[model samples]
Target: MTLPSRNIFRYKTETRQSMHSLSPFMSDDVVPGVNHSPVKAPRKVPRSPYKVLDAPALQDDFYLNLVDWSSHNVLAVGLGNCVYLWNACSSKVTKLCDLGVDDCVCSVGWAQRGTHLAVGTNNGKVQ
Candidate 1:
């Protein structure tokens, strides 16, 4: 047996009434009948970096976080087995420590005071 044909595309009065009731809660700026246009000011931003620092032997592993910024505006980067600290104010790069050729740095983090730095190595050593 065949089922009776039904108009699936018939206009829904209930949907229209519900939407009309919610019109008061909706923003006037987004409604179709509203004429007001919001003005947005353009933001100014530099297209390129102001300064660039060369970091050699920086690891590209996604799981390893080899760089960290301290509260004192100092950036610590782990490159190979060596850890370097770059000061943003002076633009000076200082070699903090070297784990030697036998082991490579896995991660680096700065203490809350920004005075101490923690270095993690692939050989399960923290320096």
Candidate 2:
């Protein structure tokens, strides 16, 4: 959804079974830290004041549950049993993981001390 803040849009998921968070610094080689939670998400684009830098066709996977952004990349999970890491700048697809959770993610978090992440799920589990 477009926020009243203008130029700010909120993206949510459709099948929020699990949410994930990735630190921006880890990637392309290292696994980086991941956090999971219960949340259904699909690729989607809410109205934005600024021109969307990415392709317009990706508005379908709006995440409804939880998402996290580090200094670099973003992580999200849905009911698809797979985790996704997105590039914040170019709106590019980065990492995908079939964690086998196969449920819903409720929330995601970035570790303040480091580049790690934490994920929460409705199944009463944390990863």
Candidate 3:
């Protein structure tokens, strides 16, 4: 029977000097302090200025974009087949447009300039 040859390490070995001391500073008598107290978060409360008013006939479908508020403080809402514009500053509501009975208002959006309004209908028309 032939004996198998054993692999030997053939690389040059070098030792590096550590910048920090390697002395064991930790002892069995030393105990770690506990910081198990729960952190408290700052309390935040919301304030409302006006009373709640029911917006009837407003579409509640999540997939449908039905209402939009403009930077000019104008709120445009699509109710059934009609598009109503509410001015936050003046506190007035005006009917912007009313679509035909066959088509209901699907979505309403305001221009960035706040000068124009866009309304979408179920019958595939944007006005």
Candidate 4:
């Protein structure tokens, strides 16, 4: 004997009214005016597929550094006397700062919670 559990269930086609009836959150107050706006073509800018630092703009010994998301959302690298941060998503260099460094950055790392930045330099004795 065939059991009811072996029966195939046909999916019921849902109508706009039926869907609205099933959920009280749906409303029928959609705009009724026809849209006269022109359709726009999809933008064709190239996409960068990387999400992490790819060393695309390191030019010096890599020293002075800070994280300013408005500049480089991913990471801000300080290159000796010149500091730069790149866009985290596009890998584009966004901000640049110059430090009067006669040498490379001796110390650079994220702050305690990674929400802030800290940098150190060496004059001749201490780093």
Candidate 5:
């Protein structure tokens, strides 16, 4: 008992014909009610960073947030036992504080007004 051979070409032609009869747009050229204007490509973006800062002994701990950007465009970074403040506008780096050899900076944060910065140390102290 052998099954009848199927004609793939004939099946595809029938399917195409049925689809063309059902849809208003038969050909692949254009849709029945749509504009076919050329679309503008997006503008190219710079691959490199605008600026870079050298941060020595910056902690790579997952739970610690050692870097923070203030609303006044100041960047606070905790590097080992010292916390430094970098002004984005002037590009000036200032030494905010040093926790000394006994303590290491854990995290750094800026105040809401961006006028003050808080530094947390591993010795359970906040400066």
Candidate 6:
């Protein structure tokens, strides 16, 4: 017969002092130090991908958008079970369609007059 240890509940943290303690939103045209942070314009360097095809097995999968650039220029790549058709004006690399082996092509759209090529599958099958 020995059981008596249960009393630890202390709660008293009152901290509410803000009658505009030196501009804590007290505005009558406030600009004491001026630092709202917004004047950044000097970062332009991104132009080096006219063509760089080499997607072996390609299933990196970032929610799978799997490459697509066509307005008759054509690029559509979805690798794993094949769906490659890069033809930027006859730089040629066509193999389009092979979603076999239990399907793993993922996603590859190219039909805005590129003559239709919408293969997407991880067993979801878009074709």
Best by TM-score: 1
Candidate 5 clashes between residue pairs 3 or more apart in a chain or in different chains: none
- With candidate 6 superimposed using the best TM-score fit, by how many Å does residue 81's alpha carbon deviate from the native? 7.1
Quantify all predictions' global Cα lDDT against the true fold.
0.85, 0.53, 0.79, 0.51, 0.84, 0.78
Q: List the residue pairs that clash in candidate 1.
A: none
Candidate 6 regions with alpha-carbon error over 4 angstroms: 1-50, 58-68, 72-74, 81-102, 113-117, 122-124
Give the Å error, residue 123, model 2.
Answer: 2.0
> What tens-digit string does per-residue lDDT give for candidate 2 at 1-127?
8548433464754454222235464344544354344678987877765643332222244543455666545544333444466666676675444456556555566776427766666576778
Each candidate structure's count of clashing pairs = 0, 44, 0, 2, 0, 0
User: Least accurate stretch of 10 residues (summed lDDT) in model 5?
Assistant: 11-20
> Could you give candidate 3's per-residue lDDT for residues 1-127 as a string of tens digits?
9765454563555466333335376443444463345989989765964645457987679877888999899888899988888888888999888786888988888899888888988988889
Question: Per-residue lDDT of 1-127 in model 1, one digit per residue for the tens?
Answer: 9876476676654443333356666653465665465977898889998998799778788999899999999999999989999999999989988898899999999999998999999999888
RMSD versus native structure for model 1: 5.5
lDDT of 5 by residue, 7-119 (tens): 64555444443434556656665554665668889998899978877897787889898999999999999998888899999999999888889999898889999998888
Whole-structure CA lDDT of model 2: 0.53
- Model 5 CA lDDT for position 1: 100
Better lDDT candidate (2, 5) = 5
* True-vs-predicted CA distance for residue 83, candidate 4, Å: 2.0
- Candidate 4 lDDT: 0.51
Model 5 CA lDDT for position 110: 90
User: What TM-score does candidate 4 reach?
Assistant: 0.35
RMSD of 2: 26.9
Cα lDDT tens digits for candidate 6, 32-56: 4666669999998878876678887
Name the candidate that leads on lDDT: 1
- The candidate with the higher lDDT, 1 or 6, is 1
Clashes of 2: 44
